[model samples]
Target chain A: MATTENGPGALEPRPAPPKEQRFSLNAIQELEEIASHYPERKAACLPALWIAQREYGGYLTPAAIQEVADRLGMSYAEVEGVATFYTMYNLRPRGRHHLEVCTCLTCAVMGAYDVVHELERALGIEVGGTTRDGEFTLSEVECLDYCGAATVVQVGDRYFTHVTADNVLNLIEELRQSEEYTPVKLADAIVKLHLPGSSQTGGGSRTGEQIRNNELY
Target chain B: MGIRNLLFEHRDVENIQDIAVYEKHGGYRGLKKAVKMERSAVIEEIKTSGLRGRGGAGFPTGIKWSGIPQNDDKPHYIICNADEGEPGTYKDRELMLKLPHLLVEGMIIAGYALRGTAGYIYIRGEYVEPAWQVRKAIDQAYRAGYLGKNILGVKGFNFDLYIHMGAGSYECGEESALMSSLMGERGQPRLKFPHAPYPTVEGVWKSPTLINNVETFCAAAKILDMGGAEYARLGTERSKGTKIFSVSGHVARPANYEVEMGTPLMELIEAAGGVVGGALKAVIPGGSSVQIVRAEDCPRVNLDYESCQQNGTLLGSGGFMVFNDRTDIVLLMKRTAEFYMHESCGKCTPCREGTRWIYKILDRITSGGGQPGDVELLLDICSQIDGRSYCGLGDAAAWPIVGAIKAFREEFDYWIAHKRSPVGPGHVPPTPEVVNPLLTLVPA
Candidate 1:
C-alpha cells in the first residue's frame, strides 16, 4: 500500500467527468427525508453514500461519490473523505457477499484465524481477495461487538455467531443458496433505516425466517 | 451480589421489543412520571441516584444533565452514543436490541429534562439488526405519543428522536467525534473544554448538546421509575446502579451479565460459567482499554470504579474479557494494539503515528524479532501517546500495553530470549504474517 500525503492510498483527484445521476426518484426522496432529520444538508453525507452504494451496486465508485455529493450539496472530495473514513463503505467493487470475519482480541483467541484460513483455502482467495466467481470476498474485521458469540462473521447486515473453522464451511454453503445478505442488500437496509416508515416496509438484512424465529433480539 | 438485572429484567420476555409488551411490563411510567414533575426535579432525581456515565468514562450523569443551560433560547439536543465499538463490550447492543423501548423512553425523559428539540442515536453501521430494532421502537414511540410534538399533551414541549448510523468508525464513540460524525464530517474528534466549549455549551450544530451512553440513559429511565434514592441503594457510594459487563474471551457462557457495581470480579466469572479450556490466567476487568489483572489480584478487585482504580485499572465500559492459561499475553497485546492501530482516526499525531508504531513493535516481537530494549521502547512510545491526543482513544491504546508490561513483562522477555511464548506452542493469536511488505525493510 502506498502512503500519500493525504493518507493511505488516498483517492487521487481526477478531472470531473460529465455528471450521470444514478439515484432513483425514491433514493432522492429518501436522501431528502434523512437530510431533513438534521439541521443542515451536509449531515446527510453518510446516509447519501449508503444510498449511492446501493444504487451503484455495493461499492462507491468516483461517480457514486459524485452522485452523493451532488445530492447533499457537498463537494465530491468531502463526501469521499466521509466514505473513506468509515470502514463499512466499500470504496471498491466487492464480491456478491463480503464475509467480514472478526479477528480482534476475543475472536483471535477463539480461533478466528483458523476460520479465516478455512475460508481462504475453500474460496482459493486470501483475506483481502475476492473469489473468481464473484461470490465472496473475505476480510478480517475488528470486533463486531458480539464477542459473547465468538468468531462472529458478518455477511451484510446479518451476524453469524459462534462461527468456528468447523462450522464456517456450512455457513458458506448456506450463503451460496441465499441472496439475503449481499452488500447491496446491506446498503438498501441501511438506506431504508433512515426513512421514517421503513420498519413497516421491512427493510434490513435479517431473513424472514430469522425474524420469525425471533433470532435478531 | 451477582446478576442484578434492572434494565435486563424484561430482556428475556417474548416480544419485549414491541411497545405494547414493554408497556405491559410497566414501560413509559418513567416518562409519564417525568412529564408531571418540574424539569429541575427530573435532574434532581438523577442527581440523587448517583448514576455515572456507563460509556467507560464513569462521569456523573446528573451533573451532565444539569450542565445544559436551562430554558435557553437555543434548542438543546440529546445524543446517544450507541456506537458500541470497544472490542470486548457489547452491552449497548443488547440494550438497544431487546429493550429498545427502554432506551427510547430514557432519551425522551432526557429530552424533557433538558428541553431538547431532538435526540439522535448514533448507532454503528455494522449493527444493522440492532438499529432496525431501534427504528421499530422509535416508530412505535411516535405512534404511541412518546416521541414527536407535545408529548403527553404538554403544550410547547416537543422532542423528535431520529437514528443516525455511523459508517463504522470507533473514534465516533467519543462525544465530540460523535457530534462531528453526526454533522456528516470525517469522524475525527474536536478540541475539548478550555480549548472549545463543553458539549453541553456548544455541540452538534453548535447548540447546547448533551451526550450519554445507551446504558446511562436506560438507567436514567429506571432511576425515574424506581425513585432515585431506591436506585442509589443498588451499587457502591460513587458507582450507583447495576453495570452490564459483556464477559467474553475464554468463558463457558460468554454473555452480558448485569451485576451490582460492587460485586466480586470472581463471582461474575462464576456467573459466566467460569473459565473454559484452562485455569483463569488473567482478566481485562473493564474492556481491553483497562489494565490486565493477574489471577492473584482478581479476588481483591471489585467491579466498582474506586475498587478497580485501587487495583490499577478503571472499570472501563465493563467489557470484562477473561483469559485462560493457554492464552499468550504478548500475542494478546499484539492483537489489542492492532485494533487500536486500525481504529485510530488519524486526527492526532500521537494516536495516528503512535498506534502504528506500537503495532509494528508488537508484530515484530511476536514474529521472533524482539530485542532487549524493545519492551522499554514500547513503554516509552505508550507514555508519549497517552494523554497526548485530543480524545481518550490515544490513552486507551496506551493503557493496555503499559499495563501488560506492568503485569506480564516476563512474557515479553520470554518471547525475546527463548523466541517462543512463555505458554508454549499452540498458543492463540496465529503467528503474524508479513501483511505489510514495508515491515520487511525494517531492521530486525
Candidate 2:
C-alpha cells in the first residue's frame, strides 16, 4: 500500500462513521412545508440545508449534509456541492459569534481594512480563525450591500452599520457581553424567515416590535 | 431634478410595512386596477410607462413582461430577483425592509398580468431581517385575499407568493443563476440567448417563467397605481420614471435618493450633502461594475442610461459611490479586484482565472512588485475576460479595472514606478499585513 504524504493535500486520517440523524421533528416538518412551496422536491435543497445547518448547530457536518441529501432525495455529492458553494454555510464549526466585516469597494475606501486589522489585533486571530475562547470568528467579507453604512459588519441576522476602526473594538466589547447574534442564532433566523407566521411566533433575534418599529438596520 | 418620490411617496408613513397601514396609503390599488383590466391592457400600460430594469441592465421592463407567451397553460412562474449583492447597492434591502407590502403588491400585479401560477422572491440569505418583513407581508396578503385563489375576488385569477432566500452567492443575483439556484443547484450562470432559451420561455423546471429585479417589480406596481403615461412623464425620454441611487462613501448624508432619470450626476452628490471628509476625487456612478468618472468629468454625466453610456459608464443598479481626495485609486482598484475574484462563480474559465490574475497583478503592483509592463498586462488580461465569459460577471470584473486604467493611468504608472501609491501613505484601504505569512516568503 502506498504511504500517505505529510503536507498539504495529504490524506491520512479517516473520518469517523456518520452520526445518527440530527433533524428534529420540527426541522423535518419545516423542511417538508418548504418543499411543498416548490414544484419539485429537489427545489427544497437550499432550504433543507438551512434546516440542517440549524439542526446541526450552525455548521454542516458530513452527517448533516447526508441528512439534507436524504431528506431532499438528492445525491450527497450534489447536496455537498451546494453546501460548499455558498459562503454563509459553515462547513466547519465556527466561534459562537461570526463577525463578517464588509471590505468591498465602498467599505474599502471608508477604512474597512482598518476595521479588519483592528478586529484581528483585538481578537489575536487572523481573518479566518476563531478565537481560542470560542467567542468570535473574524473574517473579511465582500460587500454586505449596505454600502450606505460603509464598513458594515454582519453578526447573525443583524447588520451593525457605520463601524469604524475607532468604534470596532467598542462593538467587539458589546458583542462580548451579548448572547444574541450567534452563528446558531443566524441559522435559526434564516430557517425561520422561510416559514410562514414566523414573524408572529417571534423567530430570530429581532422582536415583532422591533420589526414594526422600523428599528432594524 | 431633486428627489421625486413615486415608489417612496408613502415611505415615511408609520407602520407602512403593515397591510392595514399600506392599504391606507393607496397600496394594492394597482393590483385591484390590474386585476380589473384585460391582461393585454395591463401589459400595454407597462409598455406605455417605458420602465427599464433597475437591476444593472437597463432592459425595458414592459418588453420583458410581454415576452412570456400569453394564454399558456404551462404553469407560468414569476421570480422577483431580490438577491441584491452589488457592492454599493442596497435599494432592494430598504424596499423589502420598509415597504414589504409594496413588493408583494408588485409581484401580485405581475402574476395577474402574466397569468402566473405562483411567485418566488429570491432574496439573499444575509437579508434575514428584510425577508422576515416580506414573509409577514405575504402571510398578511394571503389572509386579506390579496393573494391565493381569486385574488381581490377576481374569479379564476389566483396567485401565491413565497420567499426563496439565497445562501450567500453573488452570482445568484444574475437571473439565470438565480433560477438555477432556485431549482436547488449550485449558483452558476447558464448559457444566455442564442445558446439557450430565455428564462421567459423555459425556466424553473422548464415552465415558462418571468424573472425581474425587485425594483422593477415595485416600479410596475407604481406604474399601475398611477397611469402608465403619467409615470412615463417623469423620467428621461428613454429611461423612464425615477431611479433610486444608493449614495454612499465620503458623502455627508449617505442614503437612497430616488430622482428622475436625467438628473445631473453632481446634483445627486449635492443632494447627498456634497462630498465630505475631503474634496471629491471620483464617483462610481453605478455599482462597482460600471466605470468610474473623475470629479472633473462628473459634471458632464447624467444619471440616465443613455447619458451614462455617452460618458463611458453605466447607471448600473444606481450604486452611486463617491470617493474623496484622500483615497488612493490603485488601492481601490485592488480591493475591487479582490471582490470580483472572491465572487466569481468559476463556471467560466475567463472569469475564474482572469479575476485571479487581475487580483494578483493589482496585488503585486500595490505590494512593490510591479514590473514595467504590469499595467499593460492588466489591461490585456481585462480585455480577454471582458466579453469572453459565460456571464456578465467576467465583463463586470473587467470593466472597472479597464475604466480605472483609462481614467487614472498615471496612478497605476506611479505605483508601478515607485512601488507605492501616488496618493502616498495613509490611504483609506491601507496596505494590510500579510495574512498568510508564507506568501511573504515567496520571491518577488
Candidate 3:
C-alpha cells in the first residue's frame, strides 16, 4: 500500500519497546470476554485494542493495534480504520497521565476552552503535545457524555466536572503530591484529583466514591 | 410467566447464521404457520397480541401495519428501523446479534401481511457486527427459500430483503428521515401535519410503508409462534410481551436485559447488580431523551408504556441509564440537549433555532451565569420547540429539559439563586431575579 500525503499519521513511527511485552493474562481474559458478545472473535477488535492501548500507557502504536487485530482474528486494516475513526483511542505515544478535556459542543459552551488552555499552560505542553517529564498529555475530544457538568476534564478514568482555569493549578498540585497519581483507571483518576475549595465531598458527591459513601441524596 | 428467552438465549456459537441451526430450533415455525393463513388473519393475530412499536414511539404495531393500503397496485414496503441511534439503547443490535433469523422471519410474515414485495433494514453505521450478522441471515434465507422469490415454498409470493447502512447519523432514526436516507439524500425530516393518518398510509417514496424496529418485529414473530393471547398475557393490557432494555451508566452490570412489560424499576436495578459503587441518584428511564426520575421515585414506576405515560415519562426504546450521586444531573441534561441540537437536521426554524437556543440557555445557566429569569426563558424556548418542529426529533430534543425543570425545580432554583450548582462549585449560576416558579405554562 502506498502511503499518501493524507495518510493517517504523516509523522514517522515512534520507536518500539525493546521487546514487546506479551499481553498479560488479565488483558487477554478481558478481550476474550468482550469478544464473546459476537458470534465471531473478530468483532471485539476495537474494544480489545482500546484495552490494549490503556495497558501500554495511553497511546496505541500501529504495531500494538495490529497485535490486537491478530489476537481477535481480524485483519490489521480493519483495526486501523476503527482506531482512526474514534478520537478517544490514541494512536501515538502520550504522557503517563492522558487527561482528555472534552471540547464538544456542550463542554465548549461551558468554558471547556478555558480549561483546555489553562491545563496546557500548567502542563507546559501544547494540546496534543506530551510533557518533557512524560507525566501528562493533554488532548481535546468530543462528547464524553458528561454534558451536565460542562467544562469536564478526565485524567485517565476519573472526570472533573465544572472545571475552571483557576482550579487547574490545584489539580496539578494534587497530582504532584500524591504517589498514587498514576491514572490506570480513567474514572478513578477523576475521583482522586479534587479541585481546591470544592465541597469536602469534592464536587459534592459527584465522585463515584460519594455514590459508594451513601451520600446519595 | 414463561419468561421465554427464545430470542436472547444461546448468543454464542459458530455459524448459527446457518439455516440448519435456525430450523432445528423451531425458527420458521411462525412463518410456516403464517404461510397457511390469510394476510388479514396475520395482521389480526398481531393486533390481538397487543404488541406496540419498539422504535421509541410505542405505537401499536398491528394498527400501523393495518393502516397501509392493501389493494394498491404500488409496491408496499416494510422497513426495519435498525438505525439504533438513540444513545444508551442497543437492544436492536443485541437482537440482530443473537437471533438474526427471527427478524427475517418477522419481516417475511409482515411482508406477506402487508402485501409487500420488499423490505430493508436501515442499520446504524457503528454496528459492524450486527449488520454483518443480518446480511448473512438474509443470504441464508435466500438460499433456504425464506427470502427472495416465493419465500419458503409459498409460490407466487415474492418478497426480497436488503440491508442499507446509515452513515453514523442519529436523525436517520426518524421515519421520514430514514425514508429520505434510503433514497440516498441528506436525512432532514419532512413536515407532518396532525390528523394525517400515520405514516403507514403514506411513507417511503409516497407509497404505503410499514416501519417497525428490529425488536418490535421479533416480538411480532414471538406472538405468531406463541399465539397472540398467550403473548398478550405476559404484559399489561396496554403494552404486551417482553421488552429489551439496554441498561448502561452506573450499574454494576451494564448489559442488555429483556423483561416483561410491567416489571418494576427497582427489579431492573437489582438485576443489573445494583448501582455501580454509589447511591443511586437518578434514572434516565428511556434513553437520554425522556424525562428522568429520581431514585426515590423510581420504585413507583413500571416498565410498561402506560406506566411511563402516567408518570409523565415514556417507555422509549427501553434504554434505562442509571446515574449515581456522582453524576451531575444538570451537566447530564446539558450533554443530552447538545446531542439533540447537534444531530438536528435544521429543516424547520423552530427545531433548528430552538435546539441551539435551548443548549445555549442551559449552557449559560449551568456555567454559573444563569440569569434570574433564565428559568422562564428556558421554559419558553422549550415550549416553542415542542410540537412546532417538522419531526419527532425536535420534540424529543425539547422533552427532557422540560421534564427535568418540572421535576427538579429546586435544583434549577438553587443554581440560579446561589450563583453555584446545588451539587458543586465552579458552576456559574444564572442571574438571580425574583421570579415566581409557580406559574404553570402548559407546553403547546
Top candidate on lDDT is 1
TM-score for each candidate, following the candidate numbering:
0.95, 0.95, 0.67
Worst 10 residues of 3 chain B by lDDT: B435-444
Relative to the true structure, candidate 1 reaches a TM of 0.95
Candidate 3 chain A least-lDDT 10 residues = A189-198
Candidate 3 per-residue lDDT over residues B51-151, each given as its tens digit: 88888998888888889888888778899998886766767866776578889999999998888868877776444445555766776687778877777
lDDT (C-alpha) at residue A82 in model 2: 94
For candidate 1, lDDT tens digit of each residue in A1-217?
2224557667865567457889999888888889999999999988888999999989988889888888788887898888888888888888889998998889989998889888888899877878999999888888899999898999988899889999999999999999654999989888888877789877653433454354742
The sequence of per-residue lDDT tens digits that candidate 1 reaches over residues B393-441 is: 9999999999999999899999998887889878877675523323212
Candidate 2 docking class? medium
The two-chain DockQ for each candidate, comma-separated, is 0.46, 0.51, 0.02
Model 2: residues with Cα > 4 Å off, grouped in runs: A1-19, A204-217, B434-444
lDDT of 2 at B418: 92
Compose the digit string of candidate 2's lDDT tens values, residues A53-115.
888888998999988888888888899899989988898888889988888888888878788
Model 2, span B1-444: residue lDDT tens: 668988888877777888998998898999889988999999999999999999999898888888899967799999999999998999998898888899999999999999999999999999987888898899899989998997777899988888888889899999889989999999999988989898889988998899888899999999999999999899788988999999999999998899998999999999999999888999998999999999999999988999999999999999999999888999899888888888899899999999999999998998999999999999999999989999999999999999999999999999899988788767766776645422211211
Itemize residue pairs with steric clashes in candidate 2.
Answer: none
Query: What lDDT score is found at residue A44 in candidate 2?
Result: 91
lDDT-best of 2 and 3? 2
lDDT of the candidates, in the order given = 0.89, 0.88, 0.69
